[model samples]
Target chain A: TQLLEQSPQFLSIQEGENLTVYCNSSSVFSSLQWYRQEPGEGPVLLVTVVTGGEVKKLKRLTFQFGDARKDSSLHITAAQPGDTGLYLCAGGRTNDYKLSFGAGTTVTVRA
Target chain B: GAGVSQSPRYKVAKRGQDVALRCDPISGHVSLFWYQQALGQGPEFLTYFQNEAQLDKSGLPSDRFFAERPEGSVSTLKIQRTQQEDSAVYLCASSLDLGQGVDEQFFGPGTRLTVL
Candidate 1:
């Protein structure tokens, strides 16, 4: 089974719309990270939320860590075409460097 | 200068062929990782290096896969007798450290490998 699972395997929205992607897991993580990847490239770090219930904002993207440390969510306000890509979530457990990853959410923002 | 870098942005191999993918980590980084990503799937861990030592290789799919970081900087992942199932995007990442779980891994543009 996948250690981390993301919802809405795919999403398509018009530019300027708002949407949220979820990353859920059964195992607790010491730290969780969200990444965005464009085609033909590796995933890029978007945000890393450590503390439970932690919320971080990267411009229009708001990331939240679940209180149980087993889930996370990323909400994009006023999405732009540039935001169209694959969003993946990874988690690092205590004393582990190898992160477990989720399948990913592919987002498409149409103009 | 700010992130990891990989060579041979794309690779195509035939069955039973041998291939080597290289990864140049961010300077001064202590942790290096290798991951394989299949189409439409997330990156899966393959191996890890801390400086010049390989600390974890349990994630490697099989014995046919091998990796080395002889200089503690540039790393190489070599695959022998590659099969079609071995085709995937190989990514490299570097971080400060993995001891206390404080480092954030910076990734590079992965090399997409297609085995026919």
Candidate 2:
């Protein structure tokens, strides 16, 4: 069984602040995906990093895959009230269709 | 185009009752997945289907949980004798092709099930 742990289970910040969330695991994965979910809605994919040391930026969000593929991070720049949501990191193994997700981090950006 | 869709946005059932959740994947999608999300938790994989074939169900927690994707498009997850622990939001996702590497999955709003 693979486990993904997320740091800073909850976060609150004022508008324009920057925040970083971390996801770590002992097991290596072939791909890692970041998703943001708003209240009462399903998670929406933000970005996916496949290679080691890979970084992908989506507007105000930046996602990084660890060099060992065992960890990942999501950073939000100039956060806004609309950026508030539950952020989840999911790791996908080679040849497997299933994804193992982290516990998730809830972020609240106050305007 | 419409994204993946789930029916009965909310469901409340008595303990020991049987409940079935439905999922309608995007047209022409080849891969479909089901996940369970408990309150305040990330979604956990429950099952996967490649067209009409169930390729993986190892994530299912118990024998009482059953899922089927008949005709390769619409899928159903049925739980028998629902328990309090079964209360959770069930999500459905569909991808355009096989493999989890490149094809991005589109998710549905999910069905919130509450076992009373």
Candidate 3:
């Protein structure tokens, strides 16, 4: 099984502070997706980085896929209380339709 | 109605009891998936369905966990003789199609099951 290890299992930061969460694995992935889930809710797709060395920006968040496709990262700019939630990274193929998730990073952005 | 929806947002079952959770995927979605999430952990893949066919169930922890998609749109995950270890949030997701590379999956609020 391919395992995704996420760093900073828990994070607490003040509003306006920036934070970066990482997802790493020794196994190569064809595609990697980042998801953010709030309490009592399932995860919502934040971004999907497919190509090696690919970088995608979604408003205040930026996602990067390592050149080897074995790791990825999510950077949040100017965090807010609304950003407090569990952030997860899943690695899998575009067609296989299976996702192996990381342990997750619970971010608490205080006001 | 607009997004993936799950029934019985919460379920409480005594040990050895049987429980069934339901998932209604978004209209027109061709791919559906089930995942189990323990507290403080990320969601783990349980099964995947394409239309009325179950394509993969390799993630099932045991034979006691069974999932099916009869009509392709609605799915059910039935757990027999539930145990405390079965306590977790069951999430359902749907996508346009898995054949399309990198399709975004929309998730439901999920059903939280607690086995006593």
Interface RMSD, candidates in the order listed:
1.7, 1.4, 1.9
Docking class of 3: medium
TM-score for all predictions? 0.97, 0.96, 0.96
Tell me the tens digit of each residue's lDDT in model 2 across A50-77.
9999999889989999999999999999
* Candidate 3 C-alpha error for residue A13, in Å: 0.6
lDDT of 3 at B62: 93
CA error at residue A104 for candidate 3, angstroms: 0.6
| Each candidate's DockQ | 0.69, 0.67, 0.66
Could you give candidate 3's per-residue lDDT for residues A1-111 as a string of tens digits?
439999999999999999999999998889899999999999998998999999999999999999999999999999989999999999887556878889899999999
Over the stretch B1-116, how does candidate 1's per-residue lDDT look in tens digits?
A: 66788989999999999999999998998899999999999999999998999999998999999999999999999999999999999999998876335468888999999999
Measured on C-alpha atoms, candidate 3 has an lDDT of 0.92
On DockQ, the stronger of 2 and 3 is 2
Positional deviation of residue B91's Cα in model 3 after best superposition, in angstroms: 0.5
CA lDDT of A63 in candidate 1? Answer: 98
State the displacement of the C-alpha of residue B25, model 1, in Å, after optimal TM-score superposition. 0.7
Error of 3 at B80 (Å): 0.8
**Which of 1 and 3 is ahead in TM-score?**
1
Off by over 4 Å in 3: B99-101
True contacts kept of each: 0.68, 0.57, 0.65
